[model samples]
Target: MTLQTQLVLRALLRNPAHEMYGRQLADETGLMPGTTHPILLRLEQAGWVTSRKEDIDPHAEGRPARRYYRLTATGAAQAGAALAKARRPRTTALRDLAGEGGTL
Candidate 1:
């Protein structure tokens, strides 16, 4: 996965219950709205996130609706795995180096 997608997935996992709009995501990730929104749309297409229209101003008639996103169960699992893998140490490189010193 692209770093941008990974970052967005991680953010959703961190706040699974809270539905975040594109602008909120942009602010949190320090990414441009153009970049972040497309990633979110892709995630939604992949069934990783569910998006819905949110009415921010209940009293404002016909105000533009906001798109809110929440994580799916599959998404949660994927995000958890991604986060764990990101945190894991690079043991493969160390193992390869250790073999070179064996029986020396």
Candidate 2:
């Protein structure tokens, strides 16, 4: 998966039950809306995320309806594994770099 996709997945994992809008996700991930929106669309298409239309302000003119995203079961599993892998200590590399001084 691409870095942006990974990031989006991770964010979703962090708040699996909380529906996130695209703009909020973009803000949290520090990605531009252009980049974030496409990634979200792709994830939704891939069955990793489910998107739904949210109630919009009737008073707001010309604004598009808001869509919220939530992680699918598969997505949650994948995100958990990814997070574990990312959090795993770099023992091998650290040991190699430390040479004789390192603890196995």
Candidate 3:
């Protein structure tokens, strides 16, 4: 995964049970909305995330309805495993390289 993708995933993982709007995630991850939205779209398409439109009335709220996203139970488990793998020690990765006859 790209660093931006990792950042987005990490942000969601922080509070898997709490839904966040795209703008919230963009702010939290320090990524631009252009970058964040596409990542969210990909994650949603991959079934790693689910989203719903906020129930508030836009007219009454004086703003557009926000689309909230949250990690699904299965998604949480999958993301956790992926993040763990991504965080594995560099030494372990080097060992794998050596085993594969790759130079340091």
- The best candidate by lDDT is 3
Better of 1 and 3 by lDDT: 3
Considering every candidate listed, which one attains the maximal TM-score?
3
Per-prediction backbone clash count: 0, 0, 0
Against the hidden true structure, what lDDT does model 3 obtain?
A: 0.91
Model 1 accuracy (lDDT, Cα): 0.83
* lDDT of every predicted structure (CA atoms): 0.83, 0.83, 0.91
> Candidate 2 — what's its lDDT?
0.83
List the candidate numbers ranked by lDDT, top first: 3, 2, 1
lDDT string, candidate 1, 1-104, tens digits: 67887778877888798898888888888889999999998888888899999757755766567889989989888778877887765877667767866531
Model with the higher TM-score, candidate 2 or 3: 3
Ranking by TM-score: 3, 1, 2
RMSD of 1: 4.2
Q: Report the error of model 3 at residue 96, Å.
A: 11
RMSD of each: 4.2, 3.4, 3.4
**Candidate 3 TM-score to native:** 0.82
Which tens-of-lDDT digit does each residue in 1-104 have in candidate 2? 56787778888888798899999899998889999999988878878789998787746846788789999989788777877777666877778877877664
Backbone clash pairs for candidate 2 read none
Worst 10 residues of 1 by lDDT: 95-104
Count: clashes, candidate 3: 0
